[model samples]
Target: MTQTNRVSICHVAVGDLWAGAEVQLKVLLSKLVLRPDLNLSVILFNGGRLSEEIERLGIPVSVFPEDEWGSGKMLFELVRKFQRSDMKIIHTHKYKDTILAAPAAKLCGIPYVVRTVHGLREPFEGLEAFKMSLYESIERTVHRLCVNSIIGVSSQIERRYMAEGAVPRVVCIRNGIDLEKKPIQADRWLTRKELGVDAETCLIGTIGRLTPVKGLSYLLQAVPILLRQRANVRLLIVGDGVIRKDLEAQARDLGIGENVVFLGHREDTLELMQALDIFVLPSLSEGIPMALLEAMAASRAVVASRVGGIPEIVDDGVEGILVEPMDVTRLAESCLRLIDSPETAMKMGEQARKKVVQEFSATAMADRVAGLYKELVTSR
Candidate 1:
């Protein structure tokens, strides 16, 4: 395609947090920016690691810090930008972006407006629940009224909207990572030594925010069970969040503080994965977590909860063990089974890596998304 015929698209999102959505967005933008047939840009609500990383990808990034601007001001600026640019489609990530960008794109007469539902709405309680419900309702109304397509990062997420009788606009586009990126070559022994664990230790690790939705407390609850069976096991919790102190308290309260290490947030996630004998994701809900894919990419055997889009990626006993969410006994049993049979865990790790290479590469995801852009633009 020539420059004149290339489709111009803009992605909008709350990029303040470097979580799964931001990681996926950065990966997608990195890949899409390489396509000559597409012109891509992004609008972020805040500037942080995500904005910095995407800017380095040579993509144009516009930041409208929420602290500095009101919602109406953001929407007005989005409308003006959409009207002035050759941008043919506006794609949004979070609810805030969707509520603002969808209507702005429509008001600007942009032909296509797309939103990717990253995951199910997290569960909340009392006043927070009421606020979340209102926000989600408005988000849904905007999608229904203004958006042209709704993309779900997992098949389960797509099925959910379809089951709810959401318009036939829902589509599934599973998240992927850059499989060809220079592989981490950190020596496992060296990395493990840095973590203060010996060769005899079974280092099981999990990477994600320390939030209730992640169900990390259950993982802590299961540590004692593993400890009784094997004295050489240690649990590593990577990533930090609002509930960090609470989870640390829970671990200490369980009297397994000596065996559990909360590493907080770190930049060397892939390198850290190299040190783990097993990778675990015990989230109560998820949408094909990027960390899980990264772990599999590192060839670490996984023991993850069977929830949301997790089952879509991990086949029971194939790629990894899948236990019911919040089932501490089952969680411990699954981890122990792998600990007892190193060969089985190794085989699963190999299979998991193969699955990621075959089905979930960032290049493949970008191609699929670019195809959708072309289709939407041409149809218009």
Candidate 2:
């Protein structure tokens, strides 16, 4: 379709928070709002901290109280909203949003209904997994039956969905970052000193919610090993969630609590990225973590698990080191390798930054998304 014939797009996101998906949504919406050729509106299942941020940036957002857990009055309300709007394309992000929005989009007779799968749902250690599996199965079925397009953040994610038989014209669109706006540089001494680290300390940092899926416990297990070999090593964890207290206790139990600093949630993530010597992501599963990209863009060496879309971004011995997920010993070894070889780490960081600048700029991502919308709407 020509730009003039494109339809207004309504994006349905799970919520407003500082997670990877939320940050991507905010960046994409901010870019789309400035384009006169596209009409966009974002619907959040619930609103929180990011609500004001989105509004402040002049993007239209509506909050619906329907929790993504089950079918209820909330689902009806969403359907009614779609029916009343002139939305030509309804794109859902995350599982719950896709499940709930698929039916509504079909009922409203919208020509294009797309779902972007960010991560694969997995079984939890306890009863939650049973419920999660059931819901995920239903969601997969809905995607198979209703959604027009299924977009994956990485080829790994696309393969996972295909394996589950939820294939629906899958497309790989890696997440992008804004490289023009450089990360804020903190006075390295001041930031580390505030965290009780000295000038000679080598700071290893990870930016993500303190959740089990992040495999933070595994990262903590590697800390004692790293510290025993290098006393100057310190860990700086940024972000908070339901698992904060558990992670804190785990760090203490490992006898390395004093060497670890929990910065909680912060608005100055880029500045935090600047203060770090190395970035680590030990997630057991992920879909192209934006934090890793942002850290690499800041020219920081990364030590991330070899899972999901991480390998797509960081080549195993090139831009960063990729260790097996949950291998505390290997994880620690990778961090140590980076620390011992500062010059090599710096070289990798430089290469990682160049890769991000060349391939993952936010403007490039937005243009591709807009182009996809044009293709879908024009075909109809």
Candidate 3:
């Protein structure tokens, strides 16, 4: 593509930490960056792990000082930066960055301001709630006027954002992963041996930050009942968090310590995922969980909570099982149901692999995003 034809785009990250949304951004970039028609760059308001990781991946990263966090000077600097960058679209993520960056994108006379809705969460409460409601009313009007389009990672998120009536145009673009779940079986013995689990043990695991929102406590609570039903059932909780010690203690208190393993954060997430008989995500809330997508891609039967954008992928009795969020007994029952029927679980896993290949591919996701950028650019 020639200079005049290439579309320059910038992605303004929502937070410093590299979580699910950030991971999706990286995956999307890996695909989009390779296309000849697009130019990609990521901006970090306060440089953190994400900036470093993306930099390591050979992507251009612009890191600004953290000192300008909540000051008007930050917007001034952003406007100046946007004016100088010559980018056609300024894509912002998360609420804090959206409220700040979208206005700057508009003020700088950028052609498009795209906001990706990971989830439209309440960033305020109580007396702050009253102030936020007033602020939201004004901001929603500003959004309708300034923001060109909004990208929702799932259909559920699109509906939620449209209901809020914030952005004038909203589009649903599901998240995708680079590594697909192939038919080739992973080295189960190697992973089990590394984790010191027997071959006969039924492995169930989840990958996510150890936060209250993840709903891991409910999984620990259900472990005792799961153990009583089948002592061979083993649960592995991956990823690190502040609640690790508390969760470990909870497991011990429940007398299922021996049955549960906290694997912390593992680099071989796909390998770990491939080794599991069942993948579980009991998040109380979510927006098209990357882990669930990875789980489905890994060709493992899933037992995720039927919340947020999960049901969009995991059809009940199709790809995997769905249990209500925070329902420990029901969660346990679902696990036991899968364990009792390995053939059924394997079938669900196969179906999940097909669904991911059919609809949720990194290539398809990148194409959709690229098409959106070209259409919006040309229309202007």
Candidate 4:
């Protein structure tokens, strides 16, 4: 059956704000669209920034601005689009998209449906947690019945999915970052000065949505200890969220307010990464964070919690130190170790950069996905 035709694929993603999963989807499109034998397009729910961003790249896009999600009309419309377009595979991201698109793909008679679990939302406490549990139950049921395969961004996530029996196949693909080949920007020095930090200050930073799952509270607790040891040390807390005020109050109470700068929701993330002396990730949970990958690619010494797929990238003492999650004392000790031993930190950073170059990259991830698509299509 060697029919000469391009296999069409739809990327179904429902996102309100652009973040990790959205960024990762963009990266995949940037590479996947280059395949001559495949036709790549994206399905954006609630058209706004994500839809506009993808369209700007010249990728085919279908924006559902008025479609009420999870409604019968929405599913019927999606199934019609798939059937009319003659799509072969449907790749979905996030819970809502997965739950909705799975049945749509099946109803449209699409040969295969695969999902990429970027990472589950950080389960909030109380009713929020219960809501997440109910959502997971629904998502799991759909995955087991409709989806053909599941791709996890980290081994930890893969294991979790397998344990839950979410799908027949769960694969670990690990999150990757696309490092620009350009030289480190010259404005890094100016960036530090603009942040109101001295030239000699050891700038430690982390970037992500300000959420409890990020374990930023622990980072704030460690700030006073870090300052006590090295008065010239400064912590740059990038991004903003519901906990921004609480985090600020904690920093002030710890008496390290001046030493910790709250840089709210920065768009110049790469430039900030280039300026950092050390990259710290004290997340209580994650699925191989792209921020950590980008920092490593920038050749900054990393100090991350030994949780999720972080260990798969950081390599303990080789590339960076891995401390227990929420262990403020150990987190502080890891940062101070890098600050004190500048030479060692430099060496570790160099190793981390080499690892990123050799393995974790957007191009590498795209290639793997293209191969998977070919494999699934061939089996059909």
Candidate 5:
């Protein structure tokens, strides 16, 4: 395709939070922009880490800060942007973005409007629960009226949407990360020293927002059990969220505060992954978690929950050990097993890294998405 004939596509999302969807979006666009037949741009509701990263990639990014403008004003501006740019495809992520941009894209006569279902919604209660329900309802209506395609990050997610009949077309495209940039290992020992952990200490780590859906409270409950068997073990809790204080309190209440360290949100996650002997993800739900993929990429043996897209990525005794989400006893047992059998853990970690390189590299994911864009353009 010639440069003038290249398809113009714009991605819209709420990019304030650097969570799973945001991370996936960043990787997708970073790789997608290299395609010769595609011209890409981004429109984010908030400008922070996500916008900065996309900008660093040399892509055109327009921020419509949620705080600066109301929804009506933003929609008007987005429609004008679409019309002026001659954008052929409008891809959106998150409920608010889809509800706002999908209809506007349809109004502009855009050839395709696509949205990715990153994962199942996190649980809420009381007034927040009601608000979430209302949002989902409006999102569904928008999908029916405007969206041409929906992308699910896992097969299970695709099946759920197919079953619910939320949209006319749905496709399963698993999430992936860049395999070329391996986790930094030169400072592995230095990082452990900085964390006050020695080589002999079995450093267990989990990375994610400290939210209820992460099932971190269960990880903490499992910690007391892990302590009963081993005294040299330490748990590293990375990332911060709404429930940070609650989780910290739970650790103290269980009398395992000294064994757990809350590192909060750190920019050096890849470096930190190399310092750990084992990686654990005890989430109540997930959708091809990027952290799990990164830990596996780092060649760290993992103990993760059997939920959402997790089982699709990990075999019970192969890449990592899988346990029931709330099974505190089993979670602790899995961790202890890996700690006691170093050779077995090392073998599993090696296999995990190989799996990512073979099946889940960011190049593979971007190719799939680009293929879809072409197919949709052809149909249009």
Candidate 6:
């Protein structure tokens, strides 16, 4: 598409923080804003951290206040906003955003309405699960009726939704990172001192929101086992969420409180990744975790659950070790193995770094997305 003919994209998001979807949105917008062919605008459900960041990128942000309308009125407001802005494309992230904005896109006569699925629906059990399933069914119907295309961060997520007959026009686009960004400098000694970690300790760290799906409880279970064998081992958790207090209590109850540090949400995650001996992600589910990619990019040997798009990235006994989700014994064993065999771990880290550089660069991902946008706009 030429500069004048390029579509105007209105990216809508409901969240207020830079989580996985938010990070991906930021990366896409930052790149798109610099493209002369495209005009970009961002719409947030409520303005906070993310809106501020979006504005900093020189993209105009429109915020919808919580009390501006009744529960059902927001959709009409969004539709009016899109119409007034004359957006050519409406790209949304998160289920709530897609659900609310899809009809808006249609009503505004937007040519393309794209929704990116960040992860599969969380497994639900019992009455709550039944209710969730019903809601998901309705959302699926809305997606089919209103959205032009669906993008999944992983093939697994795409297949899952496809099996449900929810998304017929689904595509997989693995999340990417900037490999040319400054590498995480190895400052193990200084980081240990600053975090009060013992210089001689073997540290196992995990980074993600403190949510049940993250399966941080499983990591907590593994800590006692590792401490039983190697008393000098420590666990460092980064990121904060609803379950932070609960996880802290779990560590205390498990009697590994002293060895576990809940460093809630650090901006210097890359630097912290460098100071760790091993990076672990024990999530019950995931969709190509950006943290794991950053770990691999930082050359940290990883021990992650063998679920979601993890296997696609970490080859067992090669790039990194993958254990079954919530398998505390195996998770601990993987950590111990890496700690005991420094040579193998270093080799694995090197391989992981090379894999990320060659396969998951930000430029490659952006180019693919740009191509898709062009294809869609031109086809119209």
Q: lDDT by residue for model 3 over 294-357, one digit each (tens)?
A: 8887788999988888889889999999989999999999999999999999999999988988
- Candidate maximizing TM-score: 1
Local distance difference test, each candidate: 0.91, 0.85, 0.84, 0.86, 0.92, 0.85
In order of TM-score, best first, we have: 1, 5, 6, 4, 2, 3
Best by lDDT: 5
Between 1 and 4, whose lDDT is larger? 1
User: How many clashing pairs in candidate 6?
Assistant: 0
Cα lDDT for residue 252, candidate 2? 90
**Model 1 lDDT, full chain set:** 0.91
Collision pairs in model 3: 239-264
Candidate 5 Cα misplacement greater than 4 A, ranges = none
Measured with C-alpha atoms, the lDDT of residue 323 in candidate 5 is: 98
| Model 2 clashing residue pairs (backbone) | none
> Which stretches of model 2 miss by more than 4 angstroms?
1-6, 67-70, 163-167
- Candidate 5, residues 1-380: lDDT per residue as tens digits? 88789999999998989999999999999899888889999999999999999999889999998888989999998889988987889999889899899998998888899999999777788999999899888888898899989999998989988887868789999999887665455599899999999988999999999889999999999888888899898999999999999999999999988999999999999989999999999998899999999999999999999999999999899998999989999999999999999999999999999999898999999999998899998984
As a TM-score, model 2 comes out at 0.94
After TM-score superposition, what is the CA distance of residue 322 in candidate 2 from its true location, in Å? Answer: 0.7
True lDDT of residue 147, candidate 3: 86
Return whichever of 4 and 5 wins on TM-score: 5
lDDT of 1 by residue, 94-119 (tens): 88999999999999888889888999
Q: Indicate the worst ten consecutive residues by lDDT in candidate 4.
A: 64-73
For each candidate, give its TM-score against the true structure: 0.98, 0.94, 0.92, 0.95, 0.97, 0.95
Tens digit per residue, CA lDDT, model 6, 206-276: 88889899999999999999988889998999999999999999999999999999999888888899888
